[model samples]
Target: MTDEAFKREVKTLYVAEAEDGIRLDRWFRRRWPHLSNIQVQKMARSGQIRVDGARIKPEGRLTAGAAVRVPPIPDAVVRAPGEHQALSPADVAFAKSLVIYEDDLVIALNKPWGLAVQGGTKTTRHVDRLLSAWGEGMERPRLVHRLDRDTSGVLLLGKGPEAAKRLAGAFARRQAKKTYWALVIGLPKPTAGQIDLPLKKTGINDFEIMRPADAKEHGAEPAETAYALISHAGQRASWLALRPFTGRTHQLRAHMKAIGHPILGDTKYGDAVSAELSGPLKLQLHARRIELDHPSGGKLIVEAPLSPEMRAGFQHFGFEEAEADADPFAGVRRMR
Candidate 1:
């Protein structure tokens, strides 16, 4: 059947034992990543999506053995299944080298800096394209989350649709805890605190950047970040561990800048002080660690070590990598 025809073909599903207690909206996201929240709500309101033959609210809960009526969803609202892509042996090997953890359901990679997770204008090489190497006769793995093109660290990929849905839910529900490490130009005065700042996107296209939102900005959203100083180089720079309670694009960068200590090497938001810092000019932000619920059950915690450039910067400042192992935000009051 044509792809469009196949997508529009209605299907009924019995809620599996494993999917019990999931929210209705989350259930749909797990099954159809392409469906927008608005689309799902529209379907539910229009009686196109039903559970046990009755229309349900988006936040309605599901139980095992429940019969779900899933209408013919359009192809545009579904994540396209992976297509076969030819990959060179060297490309395949390079992709495999980034794998820090993997299982039947998921693969976690220590994504290198400067590699885009997805393609965009003027961008060609990315983790998504390279994922073709992992196809191995199945659908290409799906991205469960994203890391910025200049940020390096633990990036997760779901092996299939089911796995992708589960992992994505973990992220959306704030069940995932992520730790980032960065080198900032100056130490935050309090040493450990939270930056509760709302942010909104500014500019457009290639020039786009995130800025602290004004009180009256139309689409500004709340953003919060918790940070603790791991070590400092005598006020010149500080090594910090950041935990973002709410994920926002460039939240850490913008929050740090708001506090007058923008992360070193972040050209978009860093200040003149950061620009004056000598040494490698690459962004110093790293996705150091992540903890989340695994699709197959139980908790998964993974860590990615510092890249060579970041390690070199750490060494130059006499900061110990072992210091990062300690909970930087421990005992600090959350600023909210």
Candidate 2:
């Protein structure tokens, strides 16, 4: 073939099981490490790269079985095979140790508190970067959902493109159920009830916070949470179980605050009195359980135990951790 023809040749690739649910730019990066972000964005914007014959955004997600048309680039632009950065042994081991459950399609990690799920401004270390260490000889895992940096919980990763698509869909469609445990400064007046509050974000960038709003408020979205008192320490504080029906940023924390019992140690939502009573001041929320339909079939349930800080607080309040094992929403009617 002529040099000009070779340089203009187009190639088509099928999204493999492992590459599912990855961002379009990331997919290209994995295949062409030398492709700069600007090149990828330009390609996406100019329609040089198409997925299933449709122009897509760089942030668009890929699913298994999709066909991607990749325009040819000069060989000089490709990186040498060995030029990619290597994963450190320590990062790999730490990533592997967080795996509480793993299968062919997915992996669940008991993510510890203070661990960011994805990178951000001023945030260098995160689970998404560590996932690279686990991707050796396999497809890099993709995050389906996220937990707060200060919240410890069962975080799920899709092993491949197909699993990632299914898992992400489950969360988007509310097919997944999550249970959280928190130590609140004061007991909720009703003990067990639903908080059907609309929420709107306030502030800019990293300073953003979700607050209760009227239904007609601009950018307001409906959010509901079911909370039940599991135990209390003489009305001064209480251990509560929370189930969020709507996935809003900071739904649990904001809802708890709306009900006049912000979670203990939640400095963002709690008042000075609440913070003083929260003991060590570590955020007391823990994502204790998650249930969802498995990508392969049937049901999947994963649980994460409380962090040492929360566990100590639970013990001090005379709350039994085993009590959380029972259904927190058993008697309460679900309000969608």
Candidate 3:
């Protein structure tokens, strides 16, 4: 009868004429913006979401009158639109503390490590929830881009729908330049070069990870990263500047590992040296900077200071922060 009731039980409904020929994933997104593309695909794969009593691909088109089956959605994913989660005074202060830059068009945050950009299964505490303290409805800020839970960096948010659309366009058009700094377990052989590799998602159950894939591999997508060796503390570890030309899940981590130099503190893809070098430090990856066309005018360049752990790693590795170029992507061309 109601949306909440639907979340508690499976429902089969016929698609209306207005929704005919729409992609299954898009249909879900129009109804539930909280369900990520990956989440919807996972549901379809597990048969939690079905069409005509059979599992269908996320991209599959739906015909009018088709019976679409939607299983019970998690309460986290079924919140009404524009509803802000109630926040305590402490939560409001915590959200404000992360803000580094803000304007009429956008808000830039120095997202700390171990904080998720959005909510998901078992992810109750995250930036999205924190943002609830800012505002609600059309005036509320919206996420423009995302950073990994363990990666600290410059994260951007839009002031409203129009601003969000413009900011998102920069990323979709590949016009946004992102730079990262990482302490890798071992030195890359070439010292500096572009990693031109394809990657595909692979994992077990709820856990998913990206792995290097052949160009011809099914579902594989092209991924590229240009890196320069800033310095190294012997063969045990190296500090490097990384620029990714394409965005993919775990692109930087997978690229570094593919080259036999996994990032330090990366438990998923790291080597023995990574574990040894990490010790008490977190994943040695930081989104150092981002440059893109601002929603209102000229280029906007923002840089996030290193996390405390990253600074410690620099000291331990005998790497000078001053050695990192302010504009690491200068004169770099996008790899084909």
Candidate 4:
């Protein structure tokens, strides 16, 4: 609740009827319940706020009544010494681009949602802190996989450190091939299915990872699958594509909020009940796509596109609006 009174607690909501696009940092931790959309996105990039006048991303969107501003929450730095210099200048003016695709092992970036490839409980600048401030004097970007702090898309850094331990051991055996594009809220009455269940970790920041309707914790033993591939309805919810094979911990957002099809503006499991997301919102999830196997054998893919508030709610539900101009990097670049 610091960051200068959380950007003077911005204002200008409307998107009623269960808060439209939602996601302005979980709508400013649900209109400021002691602030936390990661502290209103580290106070909207340390320049206070302004959505619509720019200085955006706290996953901005809150439609239905648009106008969100919320500016006034700066002053909060600490780490010094040229602030870990690399591509400094406040790390590309609070990271808006780092889209790499390097070689000689691996490197890929396109991520850009309140940024945090690792570090929680009130993050402290991540993506290994601007890739260790662009790895002063070279090679330091680790983390060969991780996305959540309001998931964005396609991140995989590793320029040394044994190619980040063989790309985090190929995402620990799952052979890395994620893929997501949520907009969920309802539908699964067979709208293309698969949920194999068997998850665990109830809570602790444990950051939710359910799937135990009590049948003795449903024989938990690592059983996830996510392979939907269809769901586009709207005006009420539906826009999946998921593809996880197993990578637990909020595995596709607690299995799409335990089959209730949450995901859309998911505030600790979507069901916020709007009123302007009360203040900041836009959950429609999106880590869109990812593929791997680049230890020199070739074939690696990355993707991330579909965030114009989930393409303006699929052009406000008017007959698919041509799937948003077909492949404007469709789900963020990944194909033969």
TM-score result, candidate 2: 0.78
lDDT string for model 4 (1-336, tens) is: 442343454433222212334467765664344454667877777746655455777776644333355554333354333322345576755543666477776767767666666544355566656764444323455555566767766677666655665666666555676767776655566765567765655654444445544435633535464545354554355666776666655678777777776776667766654212313435556666677777667767766665565565555443253353222223432221
> What is the C-alpha local distance difference test score of each model?
0.76, 0.79, 0.79, 0.57
Tens digit of lDDT per residue, candidate 2, span 99-202?
A: 99999999999999899876544455788778876643236786777788899988988886578767877776666788899999877788988999998889
What is residue 301's positional error in candidate 2, in angstroms?
0.8
Model 1, 163-203: lDDT tens per residue? 87677667656567888999998768899878878888777
Off by over 4 Å in 3: 1-85, 204-206
Error of 3 at 319 (Å): 2.2
TM-scores, all candidates, are 0.74, 0.78, 0.78, 0.30
Model 4 lDDT-worst window of ten = 327-336
- Prediction-by-prediction clash tally: 0, 4, 0, 18
Clashing pairs in 1: none
lDDT of 3 by residue, 8-97 (tens): 766454443334456899778755567779989999989898887788999998764456778765554455543434677998899999
* C-alpha lDDT of residue 1 in model 4: 41
